[model samples]
Target: MAEDLHEIVARALMLDRSAITDDLKYNSIPEWDSVAHMALIAELEAAYDVMLDTDDIVAMSSVGTIREILKKYDVEA
Candidate 1:
């Protein structure tokens, strides 16, 4: 499940799975700019079948935070 999440993030951000670390945040990585953030959100929502709220989208700063936000939608990490 975790690997699936990593893959989704990596693909959305155009990064390698190895590059996706817990500390990886929206603006922390170059590929994770605003545009990429939106793409990532879309990918995650589609993959998990959950629509993230605007607040959750803004709060999804890091990989850890993303996991926590996903939990709110009942998407296990």
Candidate 2:
């Protein structure tokens, strides 16, 4: 699950997996801006087989937050 999350985030943000740290936050880097964020969301949803609501989407500001949000949906990462 952790590997999947890192791969999904990396692919969505056009970044190397090593760059996806728990501290990585949305809008913190050019690759993680709004457009990439939505792409990341789509990738996460598809990979986890879960739909994220508006609040969950908004709350996914960082890798740590994203893990927390996925936990709410029973997705352990």
> What's each prediction's TM-score?
0.92, 0.93
Off by over 4 Å in 2: 1-3
lDDT by residue for model 1 over 1-77, one digit each (tens)?
Answer: 43478889999999989998877878976899999999999999899988889999999999989998898888986
Residue 8 C-alpha lDDT in model 1: 90
| RMSD in order of candidates | 1.5, 1.3
Off-target runs (Cα >4 Å) in candidate 1 are 1-3
Candidate 1 residue-wise lDDT at 49: 88
Per-model lDDT: 0.88, 0.89
Model 1 steric clash pairs: none
The 10-residue segment with the lowest total lDDT in model 1: 1-10
RMSD, candidate 2, Å: 1.3
